[model samples]
Target: MAADVKTHLYEWSTTEGSNLPVGSTVVSTNLDDNLRMIQAVVRYLASSGTVASDTTTDIGAVDATFLAVSGTTTITGLGTVSAGVYKFLIFDSALTLTYNATSLRLPGNANITTATGDVALFLSLGSGNWNCLHYLRKSGSPVTAGSFSGLTAAIATNTIANGDYNQNWTWTKTTATKPALFIGETTASSATDAVILELTTAAASTASAAASQSAHFAGICNRRIRRRQGVFGRRLLVVRYAD
Candidate 1:
């Protein structure tokens, strides 16, 4: 004799703040129903960063270099960057520095061997808070190099060190206004190193918002688990959603 098989159905309303009683049912499951709900939600948030006319309202080509850091260097050649939050990509290569008893500073002792390959990005928190993100892929080196956002605050002060390539930077600016790209390099003779820089722009506000929402939803989804068991034994399903 074979064991009897039991089938069950579950139903939940999509209404806000509603909880229904849980019970088994004999009706056929509607697999497509849940997928439709998810699709709808994703579509709603998908257009946050899309712009209609990027050319008319985007940052164009810009090039900037920082040989000596006396004050904050503002990238030039870029027209007024839009008022909204913006992210920047930057690349730096060829750094030479001299160290004294207390500080490190860039010296005219070294020069970047290759001035066209380093890269970095930054998110400008309006009013002088530029967060730097960087990336460097050395010539003939197998390692792919990059730095995450929030690495360091904008270089406000310059320090000098003896026999060290202490402070050298090359960067570009881009945003919703001038979306062009550019590169630059800095080097010191005493130091045998070179740096390259490249830049691009990203949407600071939209990206951050999406990341936060994803983290919140992930936390909720991780706590729930679904299991099914039958003649084929037991199986567990874990579901996670992100945008």
Candidate 2:
């Protein structure tokens, strides 16, 4: 009789006596195959270093677990779905990893633009599903610059819109006027202590404020406000940051 094999790992299962007396060749062959499979899984081999990425990336047929993929194609999935499988992927160049709710789930529910040397760890959840456990960038810093708003004249009260609250902000007073007092929403308090600056002179002064603190901004935009009165024309530059 032929030896039974496990489904997931493809390991062999046979009675001890099945190989006794006239040892069955089937059992021995199946045992060797299982060993090979186990070895490949444990080997953690790397690819030839030029694997082009596609929608579904193949780390390797067997042994390869660490893959360096390069291509313009956006990867949406990894190798065939099998539960309890892990893959470490390194981006050889800039590429996008699409976020999918079912097939592929990313950290922020947003597509990631990978930089060279960026690495991501993924785990298969069976049923053609993969979840990114971790993503590390080579630069070690993730910064997003938001749009800059320009003001023509000085105003009595400056309000930060709710939408602009969640970004790293750099406000510059190119015009010569600066707001005297900074007041956010009466109910809104700062999420954390962030860097606030006061530029006395118009030296193209640049100041940054934390974006998206805890909740709403209390209806105030990030502006460089000083206690002393000055001109009010300003440009609001918003930058989104991730730590």
**Counted clashes in each candidate structure:** 50, 10
Regions of model 2 farther than 4 Å from truth: 1-41, 45-50, 60-62, 143-197, 200-243
Q: How big is the RMSD of model 2?
A: 13.3
**What TM-score, computed on C-alpha atoms, does each candidate reach?**
0.18, 0.50
Best by TM-score: 2
Candidate 1 lDDT tens digits, 36-116: 544543443222222111212122112222111121222321223322333332223332112121111112222222223
The residue ranges of model 1 lying beyond 4 angstroms of the native Cα positions read 1-114, 137-243
> Could you tell me which 10 consecutive residues in candidate 2 have the lowest summed lDDT?
4-13
What lDDT is reached at residue 84 by model 1? Answer: 32
Position 23, candidate 2: lDDT? 39
lDDT by residue (tens digit), candidate 2, 1-243: 332333223122245453322433355546666565445534444333446898877653334567777887888877664566677888888878888998788977889999999888888787778888998889875523233355364567776445435444355645543543353344644655332343233457464433345375543454443333224334333322222
